[model samples]
Target: MKTKRVMIASEEVEYDIIRSSRRTVALYIRPGGSLLIRAPWYVPAYVLLKFVESKAPWISRHRDKLKEIRPDQPSTMINAGDKIPFMGRELTVRAHENSRNGIYVIEDEIHVSVYGALTPEKITAFIDNWYLKEARNYFAERTQELVRLHGNILPVPSSVSIRKMKRRWGTCRSNGAILFNRELIKKDKELIDSVIIHELCHLVHHNHGKEFYALLESIIPDYRQRRRNLRNL
Candidate 1:
């Protein structure tokens, strides 16, 4: 394997080149945004560079999508001035000592009022609770809206629930239950809708066969572009 770098659309992209007895050249964006190219041993370096350049648009799109869906680093400590992601934007955190213990949002800041000592743990707890409450209401409403908009083609989920999932945005069980990851609240509604619609399609077709995607595309024609990370799931 040889590592090479090229400028695609003015962006520097580093890719690994693996040559074998394979008959064709292929490009892939591996997990974490690494690029890989496979080609026959007889292919020249210039030819490979041209091939990578030809795929500039596809490369750029997938890389940008990967960045959008990348997992954020968990906060070890929460403090005033810390930024928190909500609905695809960052909101600054403002901690205050007050007689009432509560949380509210004003403009671009999340105001946390604590009656007792203001600690990182307290702030984290308050923020997590707020996210969960908001996610529960938002996901449920959106799921219902999508189902109604799609008419009878989509099945109504028996129940809609929210939890913290490590690897998935949502899941549709064979029993008709749909569960969404509470962390999904951090993403924009477009991506959220894609997950909801994907699960809803699963209600009609349990597996990811051609029939399932056919139904999904009928509902969200641009689903692949909207939910790039979902393709892997």
Candidate 2:
């Protein structure tokens, strides 16, 4: 494996080159926009560079698309008519001037009513505020239900917290607090429940070793599938 810096359009992107006994060259962009190129061992560096250069436009477009959906890139501008994910579905955001300023979800769409001027900033404020509100109510409701069902087997967390987390879905602290990423409000309930149950398991076993996963399995049998689905988000 070798690393090479290639210029795509005006952006300098680093691509990892893996040489194997394969027959052809294949280019791919990983989840976080890391570039990977696979080629036969006989292929030379100059040939790979040429191929990447030719595919630069396509690669750059895809890289941007991947970056836009990255969990940590939450600061990206949320514009009107953009599709926002909430509870496993994508809803179109529509902002309009109204006497009352509020947000609502109806028939796979989000309606944002702005009492004054309707701008991108105004819509963003509405969306951000909406997500936070939903996160609190949704996560609280789920924690209560899941705890009621699994409280008999696992040690319950001392407290459950829902907050903004860029790179993690949830965290389990030794202090017996479970912090869930508020961004997960956009995801499905199963994934959220998986994360909550995961942290709850940690209250009994702090480590992710055999004992922890064993406890997790005993409670949620299909946790691995839910974890895989979470990554796709």
Candidate 3:
């Protein structure tokens, strides 16, 4: 692993260049905005630099796009004995050895299944993948469900993107593509609808104005309460 600094647009970007047996170089920006470049160890420094330079514009745009959607609150850490909110209920965390499984949910509890040994890192990784997978499937389904229910309010979004957003709940773009916070899967369905509706309303009115609220209210009579509940969550 090596740490390299390069100028991307106006910002000085520092990234971790990790070499592995992998055949391709991949660039990614993790949460808290850490950049990583995974590549073959044999790649030359000049080639890597040029690759970074070529991706500088994309890197800046990608970070800026995320900035438009994250929330204002600090991130929450998931651990054993901690309860997670899901579909309007708190799902308790429980870990057990499954010998051949990963994780699953039953009733109001989430079960983490492992094979031989367990560590905090392994548990965390399992839960992260589980939550993201759950979020992707559930969010995609709900987006379609809502579109069917309220497409008259506005047509369903052309597509939906799910990601681990920091501060914001969701963002509806001008192109009819919607970005949803994966964490929203933790909230109750009603609150989730309010978020979808809010963004959908943005398609008609891009600002928080009287008409936007009026449109939202038409769809969600208790939008105010639902928004408050999300804050409390």
Candidate 4:
């Protein structure tokens, strides 16, 4: 990888390059604070440097945004005062007396009555289980409809699965198994459907080439708007 160092905000920063044919130079910070600079394949080093200088403010702002969106909840443990997002709302974790019910979904909270002592690790595990169960049921039915509509043209096999992925919302596996992001259940139903269609279309054309986009447009005329809306999630 081609790499270089530049100064930003009085700090000297080094970044790796991924040269592409795209006209713009994009910069991003990784979780470890390392920066990445993707520039036009044939752009000169001086030109790329100028682009980076012009976008320093925007880059700094976006880096902060990424940090804000990072989910620290995954490692957090559940307890009496732990706050969690149940459905779309935030709820404080409350442990009540153990009931016949393994987990209870109250008006706007998750009431977990444990038979024994509670730990943060256990709480996080229980919450993840709850999310997986609900997500599997929700995404399974939605994926089926998209398959029914376009399964014939799918390049891979027809089975589908839904998962919770931190980086991507959906992916079409080479084996024809379509995996959807479980977190999508938190979004509106229409946006969920758009994500489903987007991944399903990928089964027909693997790459985002002209033909792939054409196929997607034919299936979903308003895809661009739905896509833009989904990104707001």
What C-alpha RMSD separates each model from the true structure?
A: 18.7, 16.7, 9.2, 16.6
- The list of candidate 3 runs beyond 4 A from truth reads 1-81
TM-score of 2: 0.65
lDDT of 4 by residue, 119-206 (tens): 5644555566667777788788767766777767644336767766888889988887888777877677777777777787777778
Candidate 2 lDDT tens digits, 1-233: 13357888887787666554569999988666767787876777799989999998888778888855553344666788899889888999988887656788889989998756676755876688788878888877788788888768766677777887879999988888878898898898788889889888888888889999999988889999999999986
Worst 10 residues of 1 by lDDT: 66-75
Model 3 CA lDDT for position 122: 43
Write the number of the candidate with greater lDDT, choosing between 2 and 3.
Answer: 2
Off by over 4 Å in 4: 1-75, 78-94, 99-101, 149-157
**Could you tell me the C-alpha RMSD of candidate 3 in Å?**
9.2
Residue-level lDDT of model 1, residues 125-188, one tens digit each, is 6788789988999999998999899868998999999988888889988899999999899887
C-alpha lDDT score of every prediction, in listed order = 0.82, 0.81, 0.76, 0.69
User: Which runs of model 2 end up more than 4 angstroms from their true locations?
Assistant: 1-75
Better of 3 and 4 by TM-score: 3
All candidates in order of lDDT, best leading: 1, 2, 3, 4
Candidate 4 has which clashing residue pairs, if any?
Answer: 77-120
After the best TM-score superposition of candidate 3, give how far the Cα of residue 147 lies from its true spot, in angstroms: 1.2
